[model samples]
Target: MHPTDSRSLAGNVAQLEAGRQITVAREDGFEALKALLPPPSRRALVLIDPSYEIKSDYAKVTACLRDCLQRFATGTYAVWYPVIPRPEAHDLPRRLKTLANQSGKPWLHATLAIGQAPDRTTPGEPAPRPGLLASGMFVFNPPHTLKAALAPALVQMEAILGRGRGQGHQLEAGG
Candidate 1:
């Protein structure tokens, strides 16, 4: 619930819902996360869903996950990223995998594509193109039953959406 933009609006909305449960911080989520980690936390589910407005967000996400792992090796971490043509989006899953490997923990990656693949003619094009074709979530220290639970659901969603060519769901996991 740590939203960096439109701080007052976000904080107000959070307060209306569950003021005590949600701490709406007007700061970078990575920094907020750092302050909340380590000694005090016994077990945690850290979800890092940053707006990739800047390419540096990708690297920051990776770096934050790496540092978090060092502090809380057993914490369950989930990262959500768009599935676009950008190199950062494409490489995120691999980077997350590398982090999971370093910690010797299992991770699960799931992607859902609601439409056809985006055009890639322009290699250096900026992201957040006209259409949002796909999105993905990478989960470190995933629950054992997550894959089995998500597979059929994603398949059903793809079928319902009438997925186009090269448009479908993907689930991958490893230790």
Candidate 2:
């Protein structure tokens, strides 16, 4: 009973169980992802990587996300933005907040930075590794069960990705 015909960005149709879903579209970009959902309700998850530099794109992403939130009965939004060496990273949460506020729904938001400690010394290092210190997944409207499912994986990814003192961390819901 599952819909196994859906494709992904790589053009592979998944073989999932009944009620399982998969989508692969490039025309509309992320909007295509949102369009795959059937009306009425279901949990929603959004993951943005390497946060787009364009404010307009970010606004669109948040708008589409807000629309999904309002349309769904109960869903969580997970937006992943890189902890780049810049000030804009700090402004993303606020921008998302503004987007949600405009939507008039109380959406939870969190930020996590995955990369080396900015204060670490690199005197003799050939060059600082370009990767996350501790990649994080920020969730808004997260399900109660998500924490348990992700906790272990985060630890593992952090340990593998962290340089010196890698610690894949979760900021938790409402933190």
- Local distance difference test scores for all models: 0.84, 0.54
* Model 2 segments more than 4 A misplaced: 1-12, 15-20, 37-55, 97-114, 117-129, 132-134, 165-170
lDDT (Cα, tens digit) per residue for candidate 2, span 1-175: 1134333333444444422454344355556656655434454455555235665655666666766666663555667766555555556667666655665545544433344555555787676565544333455666767667666766676666565533335544443
Candidate 1 structure lDDT: 0.84
**Per-residue lDDT of model 1, residues 82-159, tens digit only:** 988899989998988998898799999999888764456566867554477789999999989999999999999888
Winning candidate number (TM-score): 1
The true-structure Cα RMSD of candidate 2 reads 6.2
Identify the candidate with maximal lDDT. 1
Superposed Cα deviation of residue 12, candidate 1 (Å): 9.6
Candidate 2 lDDT score at position 105: 45
Error of 2 at 103 (Å): 7.2
Candidate 2: worst-modelled 10 consecutive residues by lDDT: 1-10
| Model 1 pairs whose backbones collide | none
